[model samples]
Target: MKKVLSMMMVLLLFVGMLAGCTSNTAPTETKEPEALKMGLVVSTLNNPFFVTLKDGAEAKAKEIGAELIVLDSQNDPAKELANVEDLVTKKVAAILINPTDSDAVGSAIKLANEAKIPVITLDRGANAGEVVTHIASDNVAGGKMAGKFIVDKLGGSGKAVELEGIAGTSAARDRGQGFNEAVNGTGIEVVAKQTADFDRTKGLSVMENILQAQPEINAVFAHNDEMALGALKAIEASGREIMVVGFDATDDAVKAVEEGKLAATVAQQPDKIGSLGVEMADKVLKGESVDSFVPVDLKLVTK
Candidate 1:
């Protein structure tokens, strides 16, 4: 009877050891991921095109398990510089910027460079700085496309008016250069060239004044969709049929083309520019080498 009791006690001890082992070997709960942060500074959120670009960057950040902090410059170069300084203060791992003015943004970019933060430019480029990459559509090529479209629509000869963007921006300069190059010997006379600052109200007002002066204008090319839509408003009010072409195919501009309101627009992939900027920032943060000039695709959109 004693021997039987001893064997039962040993069995109970074995059961206790097994229970302790199981408790120690249980699975652990998963921990949450670390939040990595990046910065994006855009020229303006007032335009739908830039809004779409911001949305694309946010989506890409979420996909890559990172957080994006965005700042709007409101199309002010001084404000853009302030925004970059603020981003540097936040100690962001990287920065992506769309400059309001290419040359004026140099100081802001210089600040980022001094901070050792990787910089990537989207849509517009800085005239001076050491940026890791510049991701944008070939604005020069897109401009040539717009010019060619206008020339073709006008049968290679017509009086045209050019509504320009902010004077010192790369977008404005490159687009103007391309357009001028394409129409040099095509018999398309640029009757008037004026800077509307890429604003709808300014574009409308400027075009209205131009219409009063040049009633024989047959084609209008604005540097951006906002200006194009504004020019359309003026053209409609004048009760004249003018072939209007623009750059940056925003959603409204594309719809306008489909409805035959505006003749055509050179479509730059703004969303792709934003997303690729983020991707390149990630690469730079990871010490990966990326192409200096990452060209996004451009296409001519016509009704």
Candidate 2:
């Protein structure tokens, strides 16, 4: 009977030992918070317009010691896609993109979403996609502002040639839309409208062609400063009685306005847009809600 009691105690102790071993082997699941890694895919760093944006984003990212990876798209949708793909491979926590084309960028945005990375669009936006936030100016309003400036400069009646920016860009489309609405039913007629690809050389060539076709062109509405400058060259070469209007209030364009060469420009604060975009991204990453459309203020520069 004593031996039986000993065996029972031994079995109980073994069971207890097994239970302790099992308890020790069980893992305590712990989840670690991820570090913030940010990426920016810009249209082009070649232009001073996007350069200011880059500077603003970089400064803000460095302020908080967050990792920032910036890539230049050169206004190519294919390149933009490749850049975003590379960033995804790196497993960035968030992405900031200024899409080259609204529709073309949807797939890239979807890929990022599939990877569980939040994307914030800056300056320009994607068409219909899952984006955390879109920060930009009221481009339509800006276009209207430019149109009003043209009318005021011409005293409400003149023949104008619209030097459009690159195709498939929000800036080009909305600005053109607003300008058309402002001039709707007005005596000031748009004699010709053509794309200048937002480049000075292209603007010059396209303006020259338009001038040949419409020699009585009274004004040229260039979508950006570079194109405006190009249009100025064509006007000088053609010896046409013409005034030039431009957008994006770039330094050179502002100087032109100050010099009485170009009439006016709608100033867009790209730097401010970049800074604000970063702030919004940060807020969203912290599990906070942000505004869907963050509109940056635009100013008209005539002097």
Candidate 3:
């Protein structure tokens, strides 16, 4: 009898232990790493506008308790690809790419998709392939607005120069195209069209060369505010009173307009673009459907 009781007690204890082991779940998956990781790949951090974009993105990321890794491509497509690869290796949850070249970034986007990472494009977009979302301004319309402003201000008959942004960029190409289309039949001739690479120094030098040829240049249509300011400097040095128009309405450009230096600017709300991009990324991570393209509004600012 004593042996039987002892054996029964042992069996009960063993059964209880087995039940506990079977009832417990795998420690709740260790809380799933607790934080989100994001990557931002920009064309260049050289301009103040891009810097503001970086700042806005960082602020939003921090607000949402996410880790944001930002990289600058310096307008090099090769470097931009490398940056995207590095971000993928880091296992970022999502990527926000402002590509240097729209077509050049298509492969990178495909690679990210293959890696199962979501990509949100900012400011500029990929030419082809799948992107989670593309958030930018209506650059074509902005260019048209600039063209109208130039035509009305110059009375549709003036010699203008076009300082283009980075070659192969959507912003540069679309804006140039729309502006040209707007002034196509009008007498506003684009006397000199050259690539300024969206840099102030390059803009100044290019404008200087153009000035050597056409001293009576009437207006300048820079793809961005930086080049417009640079061209303004050159015009001032040459003692020429030329109407300067620009895009991207950077703070400096706004100040210039306020001071009667610039005639007009196409204001693309970059900070809003950054914030909206982050919000969309969060929505995507939450398993929500987002728009394929988010069009931020643009304004024509003039003094």
User: In terms of lDDT, which candidate is strongest?
Assistant: 1
Considering only N, C-alpha and C atoms within 3 Å, which residue pairs clash in candidate 2?
none
Better of 1 and 3 by lDDT: 1
Candidate 2 error regions (>4 Å)? 1-35
The reply for model 1, stretches above 4 Å from the true place, is 1-33
Write model 1 residue lDDT over 216-262, tens digit each, in one string. 99999999999999999999999999989989999989999999998
Model 3 global lDDT (CA atoms, 0 to 1): 0.91
Per-model CA lDDT versus the true structure: 0.93, 0.87, 0.91
Q: Residue 157: error of model 2 in Å?
A: 1.0
State which candidate has the highest TM-score.
1
Ranking by lDDT: 1, 3, 2
Query: 1 or 2, which is superior by lDDT?
Result: 1
Model 3 agreement with the true structure over 11-127: per-residue lDDT tens digits: 999999999997794465555666799999989998888888888888899899999999999988899889989999999999998989989999888889989999999988788
Tell how far residue 196 is off in model 2, in angstroms.
Answer: 1.3
Candidate 2 residue 123 Cα shift, in angstroms, is 1.4
Query: Which pairs clash in model 3?
Result: none
- Clashes (backbone N, CA, C under 3 Å), per candidate, total 0, 0, 0
